[model samples]
Target chain A: MSRVRLSFTPAPVHVRTARLVGVAVARRAGVAEELLDEVRLAIGEACARAVALHRQYGLTELVLVEMSDGPTYTVRVIDRAPIEAGLGLAALPPDELADEALTDEALTVGVGFALLAGFVEDLQVRPVDEGVGTEVRMAWPVGR
Target chain B: MDLSLTTRAIGEHTVLEVGGEVDVYTAPRLRERLVELIDGGARRIIVDLGRVDFLDSTGLGVLVGALKRLRPVNGSFGLICDKEPLLKIFRITALDQVFPIYATLEAAISADSSGSGSGE
Candidate 1:
């Protein structure tokens, strides 16, 4: 049985909330502060990337952050973005950015993802829809 | 994250006493304040970060940006980061090569005047 899902906008203000809840989860799971920082940075960077991508598309209904109790912890940002996971960004340079995942001309821009991928431990991209919709799934190890 | 910055002028040197966390959120306020100070003819600056509890990459970016802005004018900038964590960041990022790191703001000002720390 997973925990309650907490959904909120991925704005800068909401990033703080996600961090706060993340701290609580880290405390309960006995994650170290250093690891907690990595989690916060990765999640914040992910949410920031999501928000910037969907800026011209008005906004998503809301970003869903689902937390559960298992061997590992996960944070997911659900947005109806027209992102394709088949761009093969797994080997792209982390110093720069590979916006090939974004088909939209305007959306395929920025160094936000470069920073995000470089910092996050387990970075994954999945196409959760028919040729669109991206769910950036990241996992951080527990037990410090 | 409240930032309280105080300026003290000791002869030809300008010292900035920065307090609170310098991150992506609070760095904008500092950037604006620095721009104002530089515009008002305060050239040589020593950013006293002894009171600052936290600083991030964005904050580092602002500091680097300030240094870039001041360098062409022959104005110099230094940081007072005696704390371990802050000092570690400077060393890790190799920013210590770009900007002088001093034990105290007073030392930086003194060294600047004596020409010992003139971009050494």
Candidate 2:
């Protein structure tokens, strides 16, 4: 299995770089061309969510991204924010949550996850076993 | 790519031309510009994304925030996005139904100020 690991400070600017790197790795892993956009969007959303949480909590730790290609291409974004932030996102209904998110600042972070879920068919949001944060795991099938 | 935003008056509509990528890092600038336009009494606003190469949920949130901001004043807000990749993002997020999207800037500018247009 081939693996790529990226770590960056939880800043908005670095999120773009993470997306670019994630897409490059996905392409090299044989992810389909049409699915590249989805991969890019998913990575952006995941990293953005991590950045938002880190900023909200005033934490300066680096966000972790791991990409692995085996039977399927998998990308994982790990954020060191409170577990509630990530767990709460999966429970919210994207459509109804999105309508109210415009007016509500607290609901804004969840909107990103909603978009991530929409873009990635295979998605998992859960807490890290050894940390106090959440992990956003997404996978797409490879053509080769 | 860096995000570029410029606004110009087209008839009664103020068109905000957006180019480059709109992500978490740059969305705040777009949001601030939208707020400035609304604060400056731009009632009919159309964001032209034909030149935009990338857009994320943060960008979508900025647009949605602009729409909500204009609603209290009965302002009209629309978008011009023709690219399939960008359109797919809107479709996936279900934002296509929320925003009046036009395939061209002309369609958006000429559409009924009432905010109805042929969207792709």
Candidate 3:
């Protein structure tokens, strides 16, 4: 598997920083329009959640990573936060999800992961360092 | 995939018919449409999302921003959310209460309700 990696401290609400870096890295490997935006958004959304968790749960810095597996570009957001970090976003605060109309129970757990699954071609979330940090990985098909 | 946006005028209201997924990538385009309508001097805007296949936070943000933008100018804004999943997401987030929602665009257009504007 061919892969490339980059790391960042995850600045506060700095989506541009993440997208710029991710796209730059992915572009070198031939990522296109809709897929590019998909990756960009999924990366930012996952990282933003990680950032919130770090602030809410206590972590040093967030890590934005990307990998190329020949046919696809996969990005993994690494952060030290509780597993619920992904679950909480299922029912985002009204202010954050101001245009959505879902219920807390309907949201359930792992909803963010579900959204990530739907947006990204392939999605995976697993514990890093035995659950000390979470790694949210998403892959998009980018043919040669 | 390219998103499709259509506009229809009923009485004094303008309904923007949105189709396709409303996620991060498409949200920006929708925001552009909202601004275009406002710039074109269309005050009464009803974002008809009946055809919207998917709605995410990024998409929702554009609407919230639009709501804020329409308010300061004392413009009317409402939404038509027929999809149950979409409705559930909005309800969970309490956004349904924040934005005037109607079963159909005609119902929202009939309300003639204008929101207070303050853009972010």
Best by TM-score: 2
Proportion of native contacts kept per candidate:
0.00, 0.44, 0.15
Expressed as tens digits, the lDDT of each residue in A1-144 for candidate 1 is 246466776454565566568657755766566666556655655554555455546665576666555666777665566665322333223222212232322112222344446556677777765536677777666673
Q: Which whole-number lDDT from 0 to 100 does residue B36 have in model 2?
A: 94
lDDT of 2 by residue, A49-132 (tens): 889889989999899999999999999999999998667774244455335434544435556766787888899999998969
- Candidate 1 per-residue C-alpha lDDT over B29-96 given as tens digits, one digit per residue, 9 for 90 to 100: 88888888888998888899989865655566567666666867888778888987667555544556
> What TM-score, computed on C-alpha atoms, does each candidate reach?
0.68, 0.92, 0.53
Task: Report clash pairs, candidate 2.
Answer: none
Between candidates 1 and 3, name the one with more favorable TM-score.
1
Off by over 4 Å in 3: A1-127, A130-144, B113-120
Candidates sorted on TM-score, descending: 2, 1, 3
Model 1, TM vs. native? 0.68
**Which candidate, 1 or 3, would have the higher lDDT against the true structure?**
3
* Lowest summed lDDT window (length 10), candidate 3 chain A: A102-111
**B3-101, model 3: which lDDT tens digit per residue?**
689998887788899997665456678889999998898888888888876565666667777776686687778888887767865664466767787
Ranking by lDDT: 2, 3, 1
lDDT of 3 by residue, A4-88 (tens): 6766665543544666677777777777764665566566567656665676665666565656666677787777777655444
When 2 and 3 are scored with DockQ, the better candidate is: 2
Quote model 2's TM-score.
Answer: 0.92
Off by over 4 Å in 2: A90-107, B114-120
